[model samples]
Target: MNPRATPTAPPAPGPDSLTERYVHAVTRRLPEDQRDDVARELRATVADRADSLHDAGATDDEAERAAVTELGDPDRLAADYRGSAQQLIGPALYPAWARMLRILLLVVVPIVVVVVTVVDLLDGADAGSLIGGAVTTALGVGVQLAFWVTLVYALLDRTLSRAEAEQACGGPWSPDDLPPVRTSRGSVGDLAASLAFYALVAGALVWQQLRPPVDGHPLIDPALWSFWIPVLLVALAGEAAYEVWKWRTGWTRRTALLNLVPTTLFALPLAYLAWSERLLDPDAVAAIQQGWPDFDPGVAHLVVLAVCVVVWVWDVVDGFRRAA
Candidate 1:
């Protein structure tokens, strides 16, 4: 073809123009290839919106300008569209997993919270104590929400992308993303938290066994003491977080695992606490004895608790490696 055969192109829209400006604003927030895809989607949405306005009596140019104005500044809109909320709800709300989470939280959390609050009140807790407890509860919930919402949605987006690509390429989820099954191991902080948690559970079990019983039967606190579990769990989690910081490493997974180790350890005691409080199971946990000959379940429990502590420490450290 001749060099002068093709007509010259028109100059691009001015910086002042609305549609061009809007597209430019949000596109930069997206992935390179997906940038164009999002831009096109936005464009289509704008065009359709503008067309509807025109049909409702606005002039064509006025409608287009209105759509552009509705989009607002490039930076804010771009940042919001690229945020974690979009990946979580704007994208996943329709997914089965997302719906299940909504149902579980909506139905379960308030009931549990109310019951716990009532139990706390009946235990002769003062107004000042309840107010302080509420504040602490709110803060703990906010932290967990901040962590899980961001991480899970990001993970979900990544997973979906991989799944889509695999469908196109005839592949499966990659092994690299899956952590290897290996022996558990952990850091100093993890060891401390695990040891502390187990030591505490062990201590609690021992204290119960040693406490003098009423009429040869163990005495129980009957006002539904299971409400204390969340407060206790939060305290343990904070300890785990401190341990993660203490064992600072190049291995992020180890830190995360250390974090989870506390959660698991906390759960065991929390479970035992619930059982003791609700079912009033006296024989469930027993004190450790130097000499044991008969079928002593307490011995088995003590062994399990000890094993959990050791594995928890290792788990915390190896969680750093991520191949654990």
Candidate 2:
């Protein structure tokens, strides 16, 4: 008698069926930022568990149970996704910072837009002029936004990457475990360059005061005369102070921040003074040529020079000490 032909077919995967469905459902629901990576990692982890279970002689149904069990709970898994490297600055914090920055930009941007539009409109602006001005203003804002975002994201990436690498090597994840940035020390050449640069600026200010090439009379606002010289003096002093700070600290945050202060102080104060004077008399642009002979730009400036001298001396000593 012919034996009944034995049916040979792959076994139905009951456990895998459930696990696969669960994984797909949960991964599909994962927040967009972490969805891709979470899905990939979870897939591999679950599959590996299935293989191990099969080796242990468990049925497909049982194997799926073990694998899903090993994966932990779905809510926790998604939360991990949020906190994971997949979401640096995290799902939560990133959104908040973005919101705040956007609000700030939007608020300031509208005011800028109105001012620009008014200026353009006053300039007999046609469609082209108005659109162009608006577009240019928007572009400027966009550039600033891009800069801030790029900087923030870069910082997040560096900090997170380092943390992950450390943790992967079995070290504890410490946010403060970040590596310190190396500061640049000014060589003798650098020191000479710094000194020469400030000296030139100082000389230029002197030239402007003694012999400005203005055919029009100078505007004698106590403020205008009071402005540039002291700022120049402060800048000179700031440069020296920065050098000293750098020498002592080898160019750390202190040096960088202190160095940067003069730029804002000098430029911003000058801009504000021009604005104030312009506000004092917008129609009298010619009034700029008047002299503030009674105003002592020189005296205010001498005090500024004294401050700078102090800074310079400190820097010379500090630089030598640090270099030593």
Candidate 3:
């Protein structure tokens, strides 16, 4: 043997080859329950194909490349493997969904803005605050609208597709099996008004924290700013989410019942704070007391707590009434 001959490199791993990478890409999109089985099947298929190519006298690299090529694009294969197609809303439902969403955003949103602007003007917010608040409400409502509509349609797509698959597999299929039409649609005006009110309250809460008015400290409890503000914001977000859910599904009994969670969260802390005399600044209360000699801070706090309780209880009752 010649001493100067080149040393050969070891062959790359068969299982750790491009075929394995392609299989990994496909399985990762699948659910955890099915991923292992899908991955196993894909690997076996790739291995069998590569072996066939090898039998035809192709080298390992060539056979592997040909096998992978036969499988095609990973994303397309993944879409095929998924129980539900990778889409926001499928073609079958896109038209109705798009039409509904378009109408909601176009007709409902402007009316909301105009109505909010009028209410703010009546409440005496200046030009800057009014415009800012309106814009915030529009943006928040728009985002909520798009998100919820898409989510509902996506759920529908999955459900309808799954039902079709089950029927194909000899599962029961009947119009008579459909759930009762228990859905109750809210008026567009009502939905828009509720959404605007939520946006206004949330914006006012944050605004006070960032920039209190020139004459007075914020109405919110300053002592609780570190913790309560974030909690309040989360509660506000939850309320907004509920409003969107209500808008999408209407005043169903389930939604009526679920409304209590956010309502309770929003009211409880404020009620506690008011009753415990932690809700407002002492300085602000003194200023108010100076103007009104008969003012009693203790009584005022109790009144506020009572009002909050009443409002929330009424809101829950109203939800049930609407559902009925």
Q: Which candidate gets the maximum lDDT versus the true structure?
A: 3
Across residues 133-250, which tens digit of lDDT does each residue of candidate 3 receive?
8999899888889889889877877777655634533355455333235354566788788878878887887677557552476656566766665565556656766786677766
The reply for model 2, stretches above 4 Å from the true place, is 1-7, 10-89, 103-127, 143-151, 154-268, 271-324
Backbone clashes in model 1, listed as residue pairs: 185-314, 186-314, 186-317, 187-317, 253-319, 254-319, 254-320
Task: Tell me the RMSD of model 2 versus the true structure.
Answer: 15.3
lDDT of 1 by residue, 114-188 (tens): 434544665768988877776666556555655675566556555565456344333453554443233333556
Give me the candidate number with maximum TM-score: 3
User: What are the per-residue Cα lDDT tens digits for candidate 2 across 1-324?
Assistant: 844332331244344576656666676656788777767777666766676676778876677688888777776666565664544455434544575466446444544554566446545689888988888897797778767865775465546555553443346535543324445445667777776886686566545445533443222332343445455455555554455445544643334444455545554554444444431222123333254435444444455455545655565456345433
Candidate 1 worst ten-residue window by lDDT: 2-11
Flag clash pairs in model 2: 15-61, 217-289, 218-289, 218-290, 219-288, 220-292, 237-308, 244-315
Alpha-carbon deviation at 130 in model 1, angstroms:
4.9
- Which prediction has more favorable lDDT, 1 or 3? 3
| lDDT of candidate 1 at residue 106, scale 0 to 100 | 38
Q: Is candidate 2 or candidate 3 better by TM-score?
A: 3
C-alpha lDDT values of all predictions: 0.53, 0.55, 0.73
